[model samples]
Target: MSKLFRAVIMGPPGSGKGTISERIAQSFGLKHLSSGDFVRENIAAKTEAGVQAKTYIKKGLLVPDLVMTRLLLPRLEEMTKYSWLLDGFPRTLAQAEALNSACDLDVAINLNIPLETLKERLRHRWIHPPSGRVYNMCFNPPRIQGIDDITGEPLIQQEDDRPEALVARLRHYKDVAKPVIDFYKAKGILYTFSDTETDQIWPNISTLLSTKIPTIQSDARCASTH
Candidate 1:
């Protein structure tokens, strides 16, 4: 049987975990599995799981862990034939352990960014709702302030992106995320990169995956034969 690579990623908001995950998945030939996308897809399909999740979502409550686990496990089981990377699930130790029982993870990368930096980046964020385009005042600002660059539509700030709500969310994430990190650390598969910029994080993630996933490291070898 061919080798299968499985991994997970964890980071606080605005730490560029999503960006890094995409790059790593592309480079490593790994399936990029996202819990948010899974939830959205299930809700759209209106499956049994979707119905259960929608009730909590409509009420602004978190979907129960067992429901999330049921949704995620089957997907992961199906992907055992290919390398895969998980993003934005297993927010707590119980979830991590449950996933481990399903499939052993090869590595887990944690992007470490200072809380101040996260707060600053999140504070300046604005979104064009129609297109789901995000702009930041600090870095990539719209051509005209308060308007999107493409459609000239007004941008709205997400409720979670507001200063007070962002702080509270960060605190909650910290409280829940620590034990998950600790659980992975105890397994000796967790690698951490302290990076403030996505550019910095990408190189490290690429290098790490090249070391862990042979297909990524052997791309040049395979290319040479053609």
Candidate 2:
């Protein structure tokens, strides 16, 4: 049997993590897991942990470490049979340690985007909340200004994407991510990609994965693996 390939992608907000992650998932045939989406699903379903997490979110507080580990670890445990890519979990040293204790990771991709680029991209970002479709006005405007193309509904900028909140979010991410990056670097699995655009960085990432994961059913319809 081939080894299970597990990896994590880390980046600041507006770093195009979602875009790159989607590409990586498709190109590698790995199940993409986003912690934010997982938490939202749990909260939407009113699971026990989700209910508890809701209380913290409503207060604009960080979800406690124990709660986070408890919430994510089980979901990871369930994914043991599949190679997967993780996004947006283990933000702090404690969380990283918690994750390390459970399983080894094959790679930790860190997107090093300039702060000015992040600010500009996020400032113009708008979303169709109901559909979660995001568009950057500068690069990908909708058919009608301030309107959703398909539904004709208004598109709104996320609160966190607004200028005032964005700086704080970016700073917090940097502060929390350093230790985690250092930890992975020490393990010699961390790969840092610096670029102003995801497209420029994607080729290297693709090359890296081609060497990391063995030949399997990457593009095959069957679920069997080598």
Candidate 3:
């Protein structure tokens, strides 16, 4: 079979795109390539593109499309040798067109969560700084009050999680990201999952993965794995 299972997960911040993508990647044997994480990794390695990106990043400015494209293209090319799921890139129409020209995505999964629900969910959000483990006091709180369940460290709220900042970010996301979503929709490759809750959403996602990637479902431990 051709090693060409490429997917992109898109949603506003705090919409559970990351969590859902992680679950899908692990369950389906797809490499999870998060663009934000990838850029950070590159910066850590001090690669040429990373060095270019850091100049903007350190200045608290977004990396230009050309530079980000340079940084991401190689990673996407490498993943074409195997199955992979991409997250957090193509935030603009130009970037989406560029990425499609380079490596056409097979699927674009959109996590559609209501703004009110997201605002409420993020209100209770806390995190472990070192491990980046997130806790939501509303639904998925840690076992210990204001502490990480795995470690006894106190949780901290992210600056971006603040109500005002989140609202601005989501507005920007909706404005800038709609074109990317429409591009995929026109191609008939976009899928939306209403992310009200993980439990309600996972069954549909699991079933889709099973039907789309049968090799993953054949695992005897697949049922227990989730």
Best by lDDT: 2
Report the error of model 1 at residue 185, Å.
Answer: 0.6
Backbone steric clashes in candidate 1, count: 0
TM-score, cand. 2 vs. native? 0.86
Q: Candidate 3, residues 1-226: lDDT per residue as tens digits?
A: 3335778888888887767877888788788787877777778889988899989877645678888888898878776678888888887888898899988677788889999888887888898765656778877789988999898989998777788988888888899899999999999989889957877887887887666665433442455555
The better-scoring model by TM-score among 2 and 3 is 2
Clashing pairs in 3: none
Q: After superposition, how far is residue 38 of candidate 3 from its true place, in Å?
A: 1.4
lDDT of 3: 0.80
**What TM-score do all the candidates reach, one by one?**
0.81, 0.86, 0.80
Output the better candidate (2/3) by lDDT: 2
Q: How well does candidate 3 score on lDDT at residue 178?
A: 93
On TM-score, who's better, 1 or 3?
1
For model 3, the superposed segments whose C-alpha errors exceed 4 Å read 46-62, 127-133, 138-156, 215-226
TM-score of decoy 3 = 0.80
| Residue-wise C-alpha lDDT for candidate 1, range 73-120, written one tens digit per residue | 888878877888888888777788889899888899998998888888
